[model samples]
Target: MTRETVGIAMNGVTGRMGYRQHLLRSILAIRDQGGLALPDGRTVWPEPILVGRNAEKIEALATRHGLDKWTTSLDEALADPSVTVYFDAQVTQARVPAITRAIEAGKHIYTEKPTAETLDDAISLARIADAAGIKHGVVQDKLFLPGLLKLKRLVDSSFFGRILSVRGEFGYWVFEGDWQPAQRPSWNYRAEDGGGIILDMFPHWRYVLDHIIAPVRSVYAEARTDIPTRWDEQGREYKATADDAAYALFELEGGIVASLNSSWTTRVNREELVEFQIDGTHGSAVAGLRNCKAQHRAATPKPVWNPDIPATEDFLAQWQEVPDNAVMDNGFKVQWEMFLAHLVADAPYSHDLWAGARGVQLAELGAQSWREGRKVAVPELDRTGK
Candidate 1:
């Protein structure tokens, strides 16, 4: 069997999402599993060189994982011809400059969402990468989730014939830094840091809705800083300048409407931290992070509208749990494997830097809708104002 090694310059490996999900869980896990197998009896192995601003921390992290390489200089890492790919998991604001340098260095690029804090910057990066003729990708892990995968299957199978509407509930009560420490980083609440619920999550929603449900053509949203004040990691009191919650309405291509509530201040009263209920004429399904439940029109029960009498119907038992017919892998890891396969085998991969820019576009429109208190049209990304 033939094996090929591709060096990956993993930038911002020190950040929480970078370290935990992208680094340890996805990349390392792929390397541990004997590399990604190709269709032609070959295997592709990723040689990740951890890149960050702090040498000691990355070195310690490398040592803890028993890896050989770690570096503080991104320029040096990019300068290495061996490093064929540059993966960015840095803060939103840092993406443009870093990715610009990497693209100029002739490296394939993959990165976390919002590609940039604004639509213009995101489109600029996408255009630059396109002009440079480099392969590019954006992280859209939610599409690969088990629940969403099952939901997609249901959609594909026509189980939900002529889908009508979708309701999405995504959020959990993040502890305030006073009595209990905030679970999320303090930078998440500060607007100056390119941190806001809309910027952070609307990207995910855009991709998910476009891929799974339907193409989003318009959006009307309301954003708020639900929590006025919070404490930082160092027990420092700070004002939250960014929006913590977003109530959104979206219109899809097939006349499907979607309602979404994203917040860090609300309590989770559902199956998972994130869930979506899709309703249609023939059937309906509710999908959580890892599980999905469905109820068809044939299985619909008859009930009287008698709330005066005690509630007797077992509403929870009405929906049947969808079983996993195939083994499910970590969402992030799955995407990484696909990306590596694309790099080595020249496989068909559609989720690219332009897709990432669309995410940023949706977010900007969502914010605009909130500001103007009106629905905003989502035009196709034509950098030229045609």
Candidate 2:
């Protein structure tokens, strides 16, 4: 069968995620592997053009990927008739303008999550993309993680019958940029640049909870800027006006309670940077980024609290490590391949702009909950392009 080569104009290719995940890992790797195979005995290949501000960086990325198409001008790339899709991995503050322009150019759009800093902007962008009649998607990479997939299986199979509650522990201590350079970009730490843990990650949790666990009816949150100041890559200290940590409690539609704690200040001592523990009436499962462990009713262990005694082995040994079921790719890469497949094969993609907008709405409401010291109800979007 003939493969459809979709022309993808990639903006913000010089950034860390853009360079590694979208360009080298997903697009170029797929092209290198003879394109992505579809279920219907066809393949979808991507023809990607790197777009960035730095000429040297663009050339270097192009050379590294063995591609001659590279551009510093977004306008030039948008004007090109061959580019049917526009992908943005730009900074949070810069994303709306570029994506808005892309929609105006009649290009299908895909971009990184936390679509905008504000809910209104996210909704507006969704409206614009729908009006343009273009396919749109946001990167919700966690849905494709192997561990999470296993958890989804258990949920679907009723292994966790009548889920009682969920606990999400996510954090890693970020360096102060003095002893070691910060891993993330400088803009990520600045509030003016649309940076904050609530804004950045709540969107992710929203989708994960809504799609996997339960639809959140309302949220109550408290936030803090644990690290008030940090040095940048250029050795300049900047005051952080945004919160570095967020503790939130969610009330789901079915009276299921979930708690999510996201922070940049906590030291990592657990299984992974992100871990989800789901407890049900029949059984329980704990999933980390790389692995999952389950305890069925039959295998469940009884325990009693005793201050004078050592911890019992019953609970310790009850968890059985779930076998790895599928070979895993980088989380971002999986979503990228899926997006390409959605475009070329007309496959159904769940992480559309409406989903993205919902994420933004969650973040916005989370902030409101924090400020008002009250629970904020989440509203569903109108996905009919109305």
Candidate 3:
């Protein structure tokens, strides 16, 4: 039995998403499982080298994981012939250059989303990877999310026939960095660092709508900076120049409209940070982070607006929770395993660079629409095989 071990260099392993998703949950967890099963009765394991900018931090992570391979030098890691795959979870501003360099070095790539801040940059990277004839992927983690997956199943099975529209609500009150030390990086609140809810999140929506329901043809959006100023850990105040909230309207190719509200300033009462409601001709379903509930035509509520009458109860009771069908894992980790399989075992994987570029395109267009107060047309990509 031929056992294949693919060497992967993981960049930005010090960050929250990088450490939890890419390293501990994906690589280490897969290692613990003795790697993934292959089609030919073989096993494919990932040999990962954690890469970052700090020696002590990387050393500590390596020590905690009982892995000796780590480095602060990206060029050195990329030059290593054994490192066949390059994964980036670096900050948004740093991703394109790093991934481009890795691609030039002939490494297959996988990285977290908003692959590049601009549509042009994302397309350039996609073109580079295609021309290089190397495998590439992006982290569209939301598609693998259990709740969203369940929702997709309903759509696929025609449970929600003749889909009408979708409404998305995503956000939470992020603590002031000075008082509570924000859970996300300070850079996430700064515009210069490629930060903003619109850019960070709309990409997820673009793919979700495209993959699950329909492709977006145009977008109209309005964005705002609700928190104009925030204090850092040092008790120094900084003027925030990025939008903390965005409300967008999308026109899908199939005439299914979608309305999305993304904000970091709002309080959440939902099951997860993100929630989606789909209304169709036959039924409607609501999905949160870990659960999905639906009401078919047979279960649809009958109601009339009456000042004194109590709301109908049967429809609420009929909303059924979707059962968990697969073993639960971190959403990010699920995508990582798929990426590794695609690289090492020739397993089919979506969320490739072109898909990622489309995400960037949506974000860029959304921002353009907000800035100009006009609808933005999404350009089609040339998906012809290279």
Candidate 4:
């Protein structure tokens, strides 16, 4: 019935993910759509103050989007009494100090993950947020995807019967700047600059498996730098020190095993850039970004293996397509909406700083597992540092 504006200081929106997903698809989208509606029939409008390092880029972005409030200094943004929320989509290395300042300023925190490069830093943030009595959230966008939503529904409805295992494939070939300008930033390949496929992706896998399938108990991983050298955006050659690829096996709580491959050097051959196939005793399902397909035990094809004969069965067609029962919003937008509600309406939110710490924990453990050449146990972590 009534509408009110909430000031949100958005930092690091000049980057690709911050610009395309958070600023364009989420925050601005919500503004354009007449704000987010709460359960009590009230509308919560978002007024974003653009904050970044480059003045030209931030100003240009603000002007292009028809926005006015922007500043390069984090202190100036935090000093604004009207700014109640601080959202960070900054580079991984810069997140801690920025978020720490926001927490000290008494602003509710929302950030992109891996919350910090190390588990300790991430946990420290969580503790600090809790002590400050502020609501906080981390981006776990993939859990809200159409396909994953459908998979979650199936899991809830017992569609799979007894779950057995999960196999996931994620990645696409990133061009070297020499021939074609690389799609991703140059910092992604530099370990000193918080770059690596393991640190980048293991956090995502942590939440996905924990929420969708089961809690991750152990991890065994092998990380590699497939392309040791690549050119940067300026066409300057540099040694790629961070891992470009990682092959991993995770042991979940219910004895369910998940094996996943993450790579930036591999070309896409699957239906989507990322896909997860789950097998159970009674049925199996495959889910991509927006679509899912399933095969019941009774309908599964049985073909005898023969070395000499060509296969006649159209195996791909056997699985039935899962329908989109409802309209699905962009994953990033969905999470943004949820976080806003949680902040304003005191709605239950699970993807908090603690959850973010868990993601960082997984990534840290995954790296340790790779280094030690053993299955590393994932101990439970909480806000108390116990």
Candidate 5:
């Protein structure tokens, strides 16, 4: 069987998420695994051209990855007809312009989430891509996680007859730069750099709820700036203008209520950094990044209120663990393979630019809800081409 190659011009590979998730773990991993196999027997390999502003850094990464292509100029890469697809993982503020150029150049586009800093920009890009008839997608990596997959299976199989409510907790204590060097980039604390807990996470919450559970109709959010001051990479003090924490409630289509808390200031007490507990009429399930546990209505134990007496039943122990019944791979890689296949084979790709635009809209509305201290409605997004 002949192995066809798909050339991907990868921008913003110098950043952490771009470097680790998209470049190394996904695109490179796909190449390492001998490409994706099609039913017709042709295999497609992804050939990546690393694009960044730093020539030396790009060159270094290209060499490290044993790649033949590296470029400081984006236009140089864009001009080349061989580069069939363009992937962006740049900062939020820079996404729109680059994506527009890529779309204008007639390249299929895939980008990291919060597709644009503004919801309108995201929608405009979606419209452009629709008109251009180019394949487009946004990173919704959480959907492919093992735990979420298990949860999806349960929902699909009607194990949960009718989901009533959902509670999601996602957070970690980020170190203050003064004592321990901050794990996240210094730019994350500045609103000017397009950094906020709500912006970073609400899109994820939107898609997670819409896909796994039900479509969200409205959101009530409260965003907070917990740590006002933080040290930068140089140990210099800087003011954090962005919200570090956000608490939100989502109203889904089927009368399902979802509450989510996202914070960089919180400490972990659960099995994973992110966890979701969904309650249905027949059962309830709690899912983390890699594992899920469930308890059916039939298995529910009755426990009387006890403050004076010692604890009777071990409540947490009653939930049965869900077995890993399916093969799971790195979430980002799985999505990338799907996107590549979408480009070549014209395979079904639902997570397109319209989905990305809707994510942006939800984030925008979430901020609106936070600022106004009221619930904001989310109308159904018109998927222009799809």
Candidate 6:
């Protein structure tokens, strides 16, 4: 069997999501597993060239990982023709220019969501990448989660006949830096720094709803900054200008109404940090990150509402657990493997830069809806970035 290697210039690996999920879990995991196998009896290995703003951190990361290639200069990293793909996980404000530079250098693009701070810029990047004729994709890892995979299977099997509506709840309490250190970076709460729950999470909901249920046609949302002040990593107090919570109602095609509540301040009372319940005429399923429970129409529990009486029903126990027929891998690693296959073998990949742009569009429109106090229509975008 023959083996091939592809160089990936990974920027912003020093960041939390970048380092933990992409670098360690996905890329390094693939490398440790003897690379990605192709259908043609060949294996493709990933050679990561770590890139970052801090030279000391970059060098230390490379040394810790036992990898030699790293650089503080974007130009220097992109200058190497062997680096066929440029992956970005940088902060929102820094993404557009960095991605543009990488595109200009004729490299395949892969990056985190909200590809650009604005919808226009996101569309521009999509158009530019398309015009350059390169393979591109955005991280839509949630779609690959075990729970969502089961939901997809149920949908494919027509389990939810004529789906009607969906409800999603996602959030966890983030401590105020004063009493306890904030788990997230302070930048995530500053509006000027491109921090907001609507911007951060609406993209995720957009993809999940669009792919699993139906294409989102409209959205009505309200955003709020529940915690107005928070201390930064340096123990300095800062005003939280960004919205910490968002409640949204999305109207999708096929008359599906999806209501999602996203908040960083709310305490999680459910089984997982995030969960989505899809209800239809024939059946309904609640899906978290790893577990999914379904309640068919035949198994639905019915009870008469009576005030001043103790309830006898155990509602939670009514649903049956969905079995994992196969082993589940890390969602990030799964997407990474698929991307590699698409790059080397010309496999089908739908989550391109344009799809990423669609996510940005949804977030922009969600914010607009919040501002205007009305539902905003989501127009379809074509290849020309219209």
TM per candidate: 0.98, 0.97, 0.96, 0.99, 0.98, 0.99
Model 6: how far is 356 from its true place, Å? 0.4
**Best lDDT among the predictions, by candidate number:** 4
Ranked by lDDT, top first: 4, 6, 5, 1, 2, 3
User: Per-residue lDDT for 114-227 in model 5, tens only?
Assistant: 898787788899998999988999999999999999999889989888899999999999988999999898888899999998889999998999999999999999999999
Per-residue lDDT tens digits for candidate 1, residues 46-80, read 99999998888999999998988789999999998
Residue 313 lDDT in candidate 5: 84
Give the winner by lDDT: 1 or 4. Answer: 4
lDDT of 3 by residue, 155-249 (tens): 99999889999999999998777777776676778899788988899899989999988889999999999988887657678888888999999
- For all candidates in order, the CA lDDT equals 0.92, 0.88, 0.88, 0.95, 0.92, 0.94
Q: What 10-residue stretch in candidate 6 is worst by lDDT?
A: 377-386
Clashing residue pairs in all predictions, respectively, total: 0, 0, 0, 0, 0, 0
Could you tell me the lDDT of residue 311 within candidate 5? Answer: 96
Model 4 lDDT per residue over 26-77, tens place:
9999998999999899999999999999999999999999998999999999
lDDT agreement of model 2 with the native: 0.88
Better of 3 and 5 by lDDT: 5
Candidate 5 achieves a global lDDT of: 0.92
Question: In model 3, where is the ten-residue run with the lowest total lDDT?
Answer: 377-386
Q: What is the per-residue lDDT of model 2 for residues 103-140, given as tens digits with 9 covering 90 to 100?
A: 99999999998898887889899988888888899999
In candidate 1, which residue pairs get closer than 3 Å at backbone N, Cα or C atoms, i.e. clash? none
Candidate 2 backbone clash number: 0
Off by over 4 Å in 5: 384-386
CA RMSD, predictions in order:
1.2, 1.5, 1.8, 0.7, 1.3, 0.9
Residue 118 accuracy (lDDT) in model 4:
97
lDDT of 1 at 301: 85
Residue 322 Cα positional deviation in candidate 1, in Å, after optimal superposition = 1.1
